[model samples]
Target: MSNTSTSSDTSGLSAGATAATIALAVVGGIVVIVIAIAIIRCIQKNKMQARNTSMQITSVSAVNVDSNIDMVTIERFLADIVKERPVRFTTQNIIDFTQNFAQKLGSGGFGIVYKGQFPNGVQIAVKVLHKTQDKRAEEQFMAEIGTIGRTYHINLVRLYGFCFDNTLKALVYEYMEKGSLDSYLFDENQKLKWEKLHEIAIGTAKGIRYLHEECQKKIVHYDIKPGNVLIDANFSPKVADFGLATLCDRDNSHISLTGGRGTPGYAAPELWMPYPVTHKCDVYSYGMLLFEILGRRRNLNLSQAESQEWFPRWIWHKFEGGELDGVMTNCRIEHSNRDKAERMCKVALWCVQYQPDTRPSMNSVVRMLEGEEEIIAPTNPFQYMMPFDGSSSQWSESRGYSTSTATTTNESEANILIHQNQQ
Candidate 1:
């Protein structure tokens, strides 16, 4: 072979070898980075596992529990939920999946709700819960689910599972064709057309009644606004958010020591303020829902009475005096059922009465809405109205919520909160 030809072949071979080495080095560096990241993650995960193990709650005393009761229904509900075998979301899955066609449902103390569909052809509503990285929030979220997962009522929203494996901690629910009652009732879709609104009202009343009377334990949904309620394909109302529910025995006080959880405008002031309350707080929220149905979400601000300082009082007065026609945004529907509208308005007012004693049980509410029983006019509402500016003190004492007897559980103890009758 000629020297010149041999040298040319060797030179080409050397260049190719150099290129391959550089490529291999680049690949090696990438692998090292990935390995380092994975190792750090493993160490962090171990620490987290250790921390969670340390924080588990062991046991708690029931303010009043019947030890001899047969727990068949509760067991059945839990069995059904477990059979579904929902799992948490992993960060990798979210990164790989693109959220498709999400519509904003609502927002509150919780983050937000968006409607989305999975690639597997499943429709889901995702509730991005409010709290982030807070242990207390995690406890509350679990409390709501654990309590509700024990039963599947026609009225309650269906929980598929949750996503807690990573930073993506959110609740996954079956998508409802119709969004929250709040949007439907107030929006220009002419939602509060009397017939549709009335039907919704009846459905919601039935759901609440189930919570009160049908369930093994009474669950008080402190927040019952339109947003918390959702409509199905058949337009049946399903109570959506269980975030603020308190489950307790029926015979016991609805609230034991005191305090209630709900939105500011809808919550019964007396129950929320001085504490010690019952299902009446829910009744109050229902009243507000009724108002939303009839008022068509008109009064973001309710007016007050002469003695009644709160704005809800103002809205109530105008409603009773038949000023609803003027204030109602969905007035066009009244032409079809004026008397029906009037009856519903009266029922709404009755449920919202300031005194818990006067408010009807959810059973009564359902019956009244169905026209199976007549709804009587509520007694004077402001009877418990504050006499002085600091009337909060007297009201607290009178309502009888002694925090001295409040549930004595530490934050570390993870038992869910339930309410019952006052002893």
Candidate 2:
């Protein structure tokens, strides 16, 4: 009887052990399934955010735009982002393939650009935007790639690949051997010659014209300054930063804030006006850029103190009298080149006319620059008042006292344009 009882006890213990093992296995399987679901949700959430960029802009208020964000706020926003996808480089994997390729060419708000080579040994410029915290960054990354990808022109910069991952957001492009026209023109050391400068201006005008007329979509290169103009090995000018504004705008216009998106000197007067700006504003900016290139001067700091200004009426006197050529003439600006200089100066003076209607389109400018026909002399520019800052001796007697400064100093989609010192 005692032996039978012991056998029953051992059998019961074995059964209990088996039941416990099954329970443990069931719990482990459930945990794995839960983890997988969570990861999938995270990825989907990120992708969804990237697609809907307008929501982020909608979240902000007009009243709060001026007061809402500062360095601290931006810092907090960056910290909140959780990276889920890492950038996947799709360039060729072979060393001989992408090696001589992807050489770090330059760096900007976008990450460092790499020179990339394909299996066919094609050369391209790659601008890699620095990795950032959240979906906003990813949206910007994709927006630039998507917008620029669709836009193709011999004069416009080309986009190849955009890496949208948890760790990276980079752009691949066709490399421009010469950097920005701003560097070549204003770099004091390597300033271009008269004929080359003339060609650059003409090429740039054609590029801008193509954006306005030839492109499938109407585009306004809001930032049409020297920094954004690139020259190829053949000295052909191509417009970079082509689709930048649209990228930040989520591919639409008619936004709440438009005033402070461009450089101070190059920005249109409408940029400071109360009404929302439009494509005409780009025409105004293009005008300023044209003048800056020909004048060989930076207009932003033309008058720091009211007393230190050299402006509109003064410049007009110089231009109409044909003495404007003397002002921009350095060693590079010569007597033999005076005729070309005068023609460009006349064109420059005409471009910055105060009224939008008075300004010519880039297409017209291109034809004029290409020497297609003789350009007409400009009418007198409308006189305007700028609020003065107590002193007015250094400037002309016709100083307006407008002290307001137009600056889109803090913007995401806007360029980080600084006050470049003029010679």
How far does residue 51 in candidate 1 sit from its true spot (Å)? 73
Q: Score each candidate by Cα lDDT.
A: 0.62, 0.59
Candidate 2 root-mean-square deviation in Å: 25.0
Q: Could you give candidate 2's per-residue lDDT for residues 80-156 as a string of tens digits?
A: 33111122354333234347433555444434455666555667655555655344445546555555565666777
Residues 112-178, candidate 1, lDDT per residue (tens digit)?
5556556667667666665554555566577667656555767777776666754566766777776
**Residue 371 in model 2: lDDT:** 66
lDDT of 1: 0.62
